[model samples]
Target chain A: MSSVYVHFFSVSLDGFGTGEGLSREEPFGHAGERLHEWIFVTRGWKEGGSGGVDDAFVQRHDMGIGAEIMGAGKFGYPGWENDPDWKGWWGPNPPFHTPTFVLTHHTRPSIEMEGGTTFHFRDTSPAEALEEARAAAGGQHIRIGGGAKTIRSFLAERLIDHMHVAVVPILLGRGERLWDGQEGLERDYAIESVSSPSGVTHLTFTRR
Target chain B: MSSVYVHFFSVSLDGFGTGEGLSREEPFGHAGERLHEWIFVTRGWKEGGSGGVDDAFVQRHDMGIGAEIMGAGKFGYPGWENDPDWKGWWGPNPPFHTPTFVLTHHTRPSIEMEGGTTFHFRDTSPAEALEEARAAAGGQHIRIGGGAKTIRSFLAERLIDHMHVAVVPILLGRGERLWDGQEGLERDYAIESVSSPSGVTHLTFTRR
Candidate 1:
């Protein structure tokens, strides 16, 4: 059965998926590259990075993932819609070798990037976007790429079937928070947490 | 050397030390002991709970602690200051077998309880309260007893030397958040995370 899940999502101990003041130069903003340092040291990140637990988790990002639904924030920095030629943070060849749906209020033409990745702009709710992505997924699972708000929206609506969040042991203090107002979310899921040697705790929640 | 630390502090995956609508009947409130279910099943919480990892962590709550600094929220329900007769949530004999300084703007006369636990109210900052608590600690380590706000206050001042947070695998969408405005706090601490068999990730942050 095809499942909708989030893989390799990193959040601070304070639960900020991304840090404050996110911009083009500082994609993760004040959090900078701190939140992702664990994965960056993994074999999946650098050419000679270690192939330990971190790498194993990083490798799952693309496994059996046929489509992706990401918020506009994850697609580009704020105000990216104004740039008519903006593709994404990723260059001509994005890592996502699948049909990717970017949820934005502003619509744009589909972009065919290098490899199998294609960016399709959609101004739809999570469910609506999931429907289109599921069709394009070809029976494979869809991944929810997030910048906190996007994932919160999906989780709030009970749309996320499985979620794997890597909790980086840091405090961002002031930033966009991942968990807010989605009270009683635990009732629907069975959650487990395991710590990796790389100093990140992976929290996996599967729908009950 | 005496160190300031929190032990066996349980929080929701969202980083809420305590949940919404806390009162006399429902201490953890809407969370309703759910966040502590893991510890409750452990021997440390029961009369004959297992002396496993969970119990070992829980037992550390009193080791080498001479005094405790707790937020007023932890002392009692909201507006507890108004009730002059209110001793605390704990009956005549509280678990804190030390001088417990309650950080509250509304100061009250000291109340001595059984088992060496004494409640002293102080209208002072985290630093000032720590100074008083340290004196009472009699050269022993100080425990920061919290309900989230108190710990955040100490973390904001960078006064806490060590912190042990037990991440319970549940989401309390609404509550007093523990990690607010302490951005980049991880820079000052060397953190390690380990998962206990009872299903809680113990995150230890020792100051660098």
Candidate 2:
């Protein structure tokens, strides 16, 4: 079976997965840009062909993934208004070129990229995203691409197989909450790996 | 004079903030509970203590402070360790004791909570900790109480004016990263604040 995974989630030193005021004009809100500065300089990003790439890579394959689940905010507004020129934040070739499932209230047609990556905008429950992800995993791991809430829902349900984090040193002092109001995730998790180079430190954990 | 304030300092959500070799026998490593996860729920902690306290307040204010900075590893350490008791997973009274700062060689912190709260820890140089904080505030903001790297240096720099945080999260994620690898605080300081609410979120950031 394809397991679910939350790989490469970057956060401020404080505990925020993303900055606030996620709108078209300013997606990450104030000080949001600084959150990923460490990761943008990572060797994996530069080599992984991820435009927004940085140096914060913990390991190339320690995370072990299979599929992808992203939120609309990570892809910008889902409306037809999302400019074609507004390529998702990942730049020309996003980080995941696999079968990417995007979570949105609205709907958009499936989008295919140069790599094996295909972004399918779905307006269904998170379970649906996992279901589709399982098929795409091809016996690998189902990855949860994020926007905080999307990853959170999976975590609350204990659907995450493991969570990989690239923590950078910076604080906006205000914005969104990562685990706020989150129904506690029962059955604790355990760390299984760690690595650090420049800019960021990477870590991995499995459900205990 | 500029005052350095540490913020919501805690272990890498993976349960190890103290570094390697932390065993179940010594969770929290040397940094332990005193190092993290006991401030969020503490008494002096306020999303906006500047608002002044009252019995009517609903949000957890005792943990509230003013400015904060943190290192990259302060949030999540995805490494395998022997300490199963080390539940670095934050539940309450996290080692923050205030709206804090997190220093990163990179990245930024962004998250605001109920009582006029905000957490911004990223790319912040220690030199900026005090000056930037004072200019951004209406009144004196408490510096986060403890976290080896965060607190020890302040003592050496003599930048901290006050300190407070609870000690309840328990020990497990341990080894040693507290007094070591850090310089000594040259100035003599006093505990200006202290409170033990239900003995859960200790109140330390208040009296001083």
Candidate 3:
């Protein structure tokens, strides 16, 4: 069965997901970078195209994912303004050679990238996006890439099947947190996997 | 001294930001659009940009920000991984004519745009980026544009001068939350403003 999973997401010491000031140049902003300090050093990230990566966790993250789902913020707000001629920050041949789906309000024409990548925007709704995503996966797995709010939306509907988090040893003290006021979750999730290298704890949780 | 604030970020009723698969195209995913539903409607947004933008909150957010910040996820992962031809998601003369700062780990060249816009990447820490932001504002305020974890960083540290949230009437049981488990802060902040317009509660909190 196709399931929703939050993968490759990094957390801060104070439980922040990202840092402030999400600039393309400095996307994580302050602690945002620190949150991913653990993952960036992981081998999983290095294998995934993050240059000169370190640690074994990064290796795990890059290998086990087949596809990605991200929010408009993940694409850059400037990209959406005035419906201008902007592709994304990643440029043409984005790192994700795999198929990607976007959830947006203003509809856009489908954008196909090199390396077997096609960006399809769905405003139909989450359920609709999920259906389309399942069909689009082509038997490969789908990793739900989040921008905080995006992740919360799917988790609320209880549609997520698994979540992979790289718990780094740092704190944002603000920006976005991991479990800030999330209501009515089963709370009893089993750890599917765990890896420890460079003090970053990689945890995979599956629905109970 | 320049201060950072997390303004107009939204969350769903279910606590999720968007629904399901995430992509650069639909970074916010599902109802993630609802988060910014208020900002675009603000008097500021309407009076400045297109005419008679419906929502009041959105208009205000659009009216203008001191300066904007970007996170890695918000900017798009797979850094510099572009065709080298495409730019960002926004068109020329973007909504923000102000100088913007990017939070990044990789030290790349700065990206300059038209309309007094220049994208500067900070390989330093978030505080260092804030220093640059303060200088760039030249007396104006600084906005901590978020992706989730970015916002959390500021919140946990209580580095924010003010936080204005447009609580959309929706929920995303997952993703990220504005305020998670940030400890060691003065909780006695004052509620500076509150409104329930367009089924969204516009709340402003200021440090004591």
Candidate 4:
């Protein structure tokens, strides 16, 4: 069975996945790259970066991922629908070399990028979107690419099979929290944590 | 110089220090003892318990602490002020063997208990309370005993010199959050994290 996984999701120590005041100029808002700065220095992101525990976890982002389901917030800025020229934050050849489904109320025609990645806009529920992504996954695992709220929605429905969240040391104070409305979420999964030398704690939750 | 510290403070993965619906029967409220079950198994809490990394952290709760300042919620249940006979949740001999200041709007006369513990109710600001506690500490380090909101207040004022927070795997969706109003708190502290074999991540933030 193909499992639904959320990989390389970074959250602040205060439980915020992304900071407030998100705009086209600041994708992470006031949070900047503090949440993801650890990954940038890892070998998984850079060629000759540190190949320690941080890299070991960041390298798992692309392992056996067939398709991705992302929220509209991640697909583009707040009013991205208004701008018809929004191809996505990623340039021509996006990183996701698979069928990426964008959950947006404003559904548009599918756009096939330079790479094997094809952006499919869908206006459906999390479960419904997962079913479509699963079909496109073709026996491989489906990745839930998030902007925080998207992952929380999937997690709220208990649709995530496995999740890896890197707890950054910074406190965003004001932002979209990842753990909101996720009360008693530990009951459904077996959780494990590992702290890295780079001062980030990697938490893995596997469905029981 | 005597430093202020928060030792063995437990927070859920969602960053909630204490659960919601606090009452006389349940001290930790809906969270019950889920946030502290890890400490119960440690040798610091019980004899013949596991003496591993978890115990090492828990044992620090009583080290070099002359006085404690806690929130009124932690001293007793809501409406506890009405009951003059209500001593405290702890028996005649409280665990704190020092002068403990309870921050409450309804100030009352000080009560002396066994084991050298004295409960002093003070309706004052965090800084003012800290000054009184410091006087009672007698050059010894003061510990910040918390229910969540109290710690956040101290943190906001940048009065805390050191803090140790145990990040439990559970999620308390509704409760008093410890990280609220503490935006960009990581800038002031040199933070480090270590994951224990008992499945708890111990985070230490030392003032830089």
Best by lDDT: 4
Q: What is the RMSD of candidate 2?
A: 17.7
TM-score for predicted model 4 compared with the true structure: 0.98
C-alpha positional error of residue A102 in candidate 3 after TM-score superposition, expressed in Å: 1.2
The Cα error of candidate 4 at residue B2, in Å, is: 0.8
**Compared with the true structure, what per-residue lDDT tens digits does model 4 show for residues B1-208?**
8999999899999988889888998888899999989999988888999999899888877768889999998989989988888778999999888999999998889999999999999999999999999999999999998978999999989999999999999999988999899887888999999999878999999998
Q: Model 2, residue B200: displacement in angstroms?
A: 18
Off by over 4 Å in 1: none
Clashes of 3: 118
If you assessed candidate 2 against the hidden native complex, which CAPRI class would it receive? Answer: incorrect
**DockQ scores of the candidates:** 0.79, 0.04, 0.04, 0.90
Candidate 3 lDDT by residue in tens digits, A146-182: 8776776776666678877665544356676555555
Q: What TM-scores do the predictions have?
A: 0.95, 0.49, 0.47, 0.98
- What's model 4's overall lDDT? 0.92
lDDT of 1 at A29: 84
True lDDT of residue B198, candidate 3: 49
B1-208 in candidate 3: lDDT tens per residue? 5556775667653334334445566666544465665566555655654333225445445434567777665655344335343345566665567777767675456667888777766766667777778888887778887767776666666667776655454435566655455532335445432335244545466778
TM-score of model 3 vs. true structure: 0.47
After superposition, the stretches of candidate 4 with alpha carbons farther than 4 Å from their true spots are none
